[model samples]
Target: MGLIKTVGLTKTYNGTNAVDGIDLSIKEGVCTALLGPNGAGKTTTLNMLTGLINATSGTISFDDRYMGDRRKYIGYLPQYPKFYGWMTGEEYIIFSGQLAGLTKKEALSRSDELLSLVGLSEDKKKRVSGYSGGMKQRLGIAQSLIHSPKLLILDEPVSALDPIGRREVLELMKTLKEKTSILFSTHVLHDAEEICEEIFIIKKGKLIIEGDLVELQRKYQKPTIYLNTEEPIEDWSTTIKQKEWLRHMDVKKNKITVTVEDMDMAREALLTDESLRKLKINSFEVAKTTLEDLFMEVTGK
Candidate 1:
C-alpha cells in the first residue's frame, strides 16, 4: 500500500477521454515525477488527483491511515500559481493558513516557520509583486505546505522560470523532499532525472510507462556510439544506416550518434569501416542510453 493508489482512474470531456484508464501508486516520502509532453494529460491527471475536477470513472484511494476530506491530506501548487501581489510574502502565507482553517495565532506561527523554510524570512515583508520569479514560487510552496499536508503536488513547478529561478525552485524541492512526499509534473527530462526517485510517463492520455527511475534507465539501456569528425559525415552515414546491428542513427553537420543492438559488433564495424576511416575523426565514444532517450522512445517523439 503506497501513500496513494488509483484504479482505472479516468476523466472525459465531451465524450473524449482526456485521461484514460490509468493506475498509479505514488509511494510515501518519495519524490515522484509525472512526465509527458504538451496535451498528454499530465495536468488532467494532476487535477483529478488533487480533486480540482471530478473523474468520470474509476477510484482514487488514499492509504487507510489518512481519513476524511482528501483535500486535508494533499497540498497543491498549480503551473501558474496566483498570489495577491499587493500582500507581503508573510501576510500571504498567514492568510493561506487561515483559509486552511488555522487560528490567527497558529497561522502567524506557521507563517514565520514557512517563511524561513522557503528562504524568504528576510524579505517576508516585501510585496509579492516586488519579489523575483523564484521567490514567488518558493512562497507558493510555503503557502501550499502551510496546512501540513502529507503529500505535496505541483504541476510544472519550474516550467515558466528563467535559468536561475528554475535552479532555485529545484534546489528548494530537493530540500523539501526530505521533509515530505512530493509529486510533481514536468516535461523537462533533466530536472525530473535530477530529483525524482520514481517516474510515471504518459502519452496520448495513456499511461505508457511507470517504474523506479534507476530501474527504468537500466531496463532501457542501449549501446550507443558518438562520433565527431572534422568534416560532415552525412554521405557516409547513409551507407551504414542499413547495417544489421544499427538500431538508429542521428547525423548532424560533423557529428553522428548511432544506437546499436550490439556494442562489440558496432565497435569493430565502425572502427574498421573504409568510409569512416577516410574522415578525420576528432572523437569516437561509446555510451549508454539516458532518460531523454527513454522519453523520446516512449513518447515516439
Candidate 2:
C-alpha cells in the first residue's frame, strides 16, 4: 500500500469549494511535491490530511489504515508554526515527543537526537523566540520528527528563506527522504524541480496535473530555439510565422526566439534558411523548458 493516499478529497467554505476532489498517493521513501499558486487549495488539502481541519468529503489512509487510526504515524510541519516564546528549542521538541505518547526519558532522548539532526544541538538551550526564521524552521522539522512518523507533511518548507537557508533546508529534506515519505507543498517551482520525484499541480482548487517530474516535462515542454544575430531581418517576425512548423516566434533586440513542435525539423530549417544565414547569426541554441514554464503553460498565464 502507498504510504499516504487520499481519494476524492474536498473542502468547501461559504458555498465555494476551496479544495475540489484531489486524489493523491504518496509512496514510501519518496518525495512528492504539491505545487500551486496561492488559493490553489494546497494548504487546505494538507490541513485535511493532518486533521487540522475535517474534509467535507473523501477518505484518507496512511500505511493501509485510515488516517484517524494512524494519526501518530504522520508528522506535520505547518507553515508559520506558533511555538511558546518562553520554551527553549529543546523544551519545545521534548514537549512534542510527550504529546506523541513518548515517556519522559524517551522524549528527552529523542529531543537531543532530533536537535542534533537539524543542526540545532548547540542552541538547544536558546528560546525559540531568539531563533532566526531558518533556525525556527529547522526546529519545527525536529519537533515533527520526534515521534518518528512514517510520513512527513511540510507546508511551504522554504518559502521565506534566503538562498543559503533555502539550500540548507532543501538538503535536509532530501536526506530525510531516505527514511520517511515526504509530501511538501510549495509555490517555488525550482525547489520542486530540485527534490521531487513525483509532483501534483493544483489550480483554482482542482488537481490539474500530476506525474513524475521527467515525464511531465517531456510531455508538455515546448522546444524553443534562440538566435542571436548582428543584423535584424526586415520581416523577421512575419518570415518566422510563415513556417507552418513554427508554433510561435518572438523577436527582441538582436535575438529571435522561435517555438516549434519538432525541434529537429526546426534546427534543420534554421540551418538551411539563407535569410537567417545572411543576417550574420552570431549564435543559436535550444532552450530547455523549466518547471516555471510548464506551470505558466498549464495555468495559462
Candidate 3:
C-alpha cells in the first residue's frame, strides 16, 4: 500500500458536495502537490484525511490502517493555525511534542532540534504574539515535525510568505523529505513545478490530472514556433499556412509565430526554408509550454 490513500473520498456541507468521489495515492519518500484553484475542496480533503472532519463518505488509509487508527503517524499543518499567543516558540513546540505523546526530555530535545531546523533557533524564546506570519509558519512547521511523523500535510504553507521567506520554507521542506513524505496543497503552480515529484490537479473538487512532472509537461506542452525576421513579416503567416505541417500562424510586428503538430518538423522547415533565408531571418526558436500554461489550459483560466 502507498503511504497515504484516499478511496472514493467525499465530503458535503449542508447539502453541497465540496469533495466528490476523489481518490488519491501518495507514495512514501516523495513530495506530492495537491493543486487547485480557490474553493476546489483542497482544505476539506486535507481535513478529512487528517481526521479533523469526518468524511461524509469514503475511507482514507495510511500504511494499510484506516486514518483514525493512523493519527500518530501523521503530522498536519492547517491553513491558519492557532497557537497560544503568550507561549514562546520553544514552549509551544514542547507542548506539541508532549501532546503527541513524547516524554518530557524527548520533547525538549526534539523541540530544540526542530526549532533550529526550521531556522527559528535564534527566536526560540520569543512569544508567538511577537512572531511575524512567516515566523509563525516556520514555528508551525517545527511543531508538526516534533514527533517525527511519517507523513506531513501542509496546507498552503508558503502562500503568505514573501519571496525570500517562501524560498526558505521551500528549502526546509526539501530538507525534511529524507525523513518524511509530504502532501502539500497550494494554488501556486510554480511552487509545485519546482519541488513536487508528483502532482494532482483538481478543479471544482474533481481530480482532473495526476502524474509525474515530465508526463504532465509532455501531455500539456503547446507546440509553437517563434521566428524573428530582419524586417516585418506580414506575409509569413500566409506563407506558413501553405505548409501542411503548420496548424496556425500569427504575426506580430517583426516576428511570426507558428503552431505545428510536430515541433521537429517545424524546426526542420524553418531551418531549411530557402525563402526565409532570402528574407534574412534573425532568430528561430520553439517556445516550450510551462506549468503555468498547463494549469491555465486544464483549468481554462
Candidate 4:
C-alpha cells in the first residue's frame, strides 16, 4: 500500500463541492505534483489533508492506518510562507522546532542539521530581511524540515521567483525528495516534469488524470513541428498548407505551426526545401507534446 491514500476525500463550502470525491494514493519516497488551473481546489485539498480545515465527507489514511494526529508526520510550506524579518534564519528554524514540541536542545541540534541540509548554514546568522527571494524560500524549507517529518508538501514553491531562483529551488527539492515523500501543487507543468515521478492533475476541483509522467505523455501527445524564417514570409500560410505531408497548419504572425502525416519526415523535408534556402530559414524544429500540452487538452484551456 502507498504511504498516503484518500477514499472519497471531499470538502464542501456551503452547498458547493470545493473538492469532489477523490481516490488518491501517494507512494512513499516518490515526488508527486498536484497540478491544476486557477480555482481548481488544489489549495483546498492540501488544506484539508494538512488538517487546516474539516472535510465534509471522506477519509485520509497514512501508512494504511486510520487517521490519528497525522499532522506531526507532515511538513508543509504554504504558497506564501510568512516569517519574522527580525529573526536570523537559524533562530527561526529553532523556534519552529520548539513550537512543534521539540526540546530546546533537540530543536537547536535539529535546526543546525537542517540549516546545512537546506544550504543555509553559511548564512544562518543573517537576518531574514537580508535574504534574497530564493534564499528565503530555502529558509522556509529548512524550517519545515526542522522536525524531520516524513512527508513534505509545498504549494507553488517557485511560482514567484525569477528563472534563476526557480532553478535553484527546484534543484533543492530534487535532493530533499531522496529522504522524504513530497507532494507539491503547481500550475506550471515544467516544474512537475522536472521533479516529480507521478502527476495528479485536477480541474474544477475534480481529478482529471493521474499517472507516470512518461506514460501520460506517450499516450496522449500529438506530433507537431514549428518553423521560423528570418522575416515573415509573404502569404506563407497558403503555401505551407499545400504541402502533401501536412495534416494541418496554424500560421501566426512570426511562426508556422504544422501537424503532419510524419513528424520526422516533415521536419526533414521542411529543412531541406530549396525554396526556403533563398528565404533564410532561422529555425525548423519538431516539438513533442509535453505535460503542459496534456494539461491544456484535459482542461480545455
- What are the TM-scores, per candidate, against the unseen true structure? 0.93, 0.89, 0.84, 0.83
**Every model: Cα RMSD to truth:** 1.8, 2.5, 3.5, 3.7
Candidate 4: list runs displaced more than 4 Å: 65-67, 227-286
Question: Once model 1 is optimally superposed onto the true structure by TM-score, how far is the C-alpha of residue 78 displaced, in angstroms?
Answer: 0.9
lDDT for each candidate structure:
0.93, 0.87, 0.87, 0.85
**Which candidate number would show the highest TM-score if scored against the true structure?**
1
Give RMSD (Å) of candidate 3 vs. truth.
Answer: 3.5
Residue-wise C-alpha lDDT for candidate 3, range 72-169, written one tens digit per residue:
78889999889999999999999988988899999999998999999999999999999987888889999988767889999999998898779888
Clashing pairs in 4: none
TM-score leaderboard ranking: 1, 2, 3, 4
lDDT of 2: 0.87
Off by over 4 Å in 1: 228-244, 251-255, 279-282
Question: Tens-digit lDDT track for model 1 on 1-301?
Answer: 9898999999999899989999999999899999999888999999999999988999998888999878888999998999899999999999999999999999999999999999999999999999999999999999999988899999999999999999999999999999899999998888889999999999978999999999988988888999999878999999997889999999998999999998999999989987887888999999997878879878875
Decide which is better by TM-score, 3 or 4.
3
Supply candidate 4's per-residue lDDT for 4: 79
Give the per-residue lDDT of model 4 (tens digit) for 1-301. 8787888888999889989998888889899999998788888888888888888899988884535688878899988999999999999998999999999999899988998998889999999999988888989988888767888989889988888879879999999999999999998888999999999998878898999887887876668887787767556567667677888677776677777878767878777777766667788788765667568768775
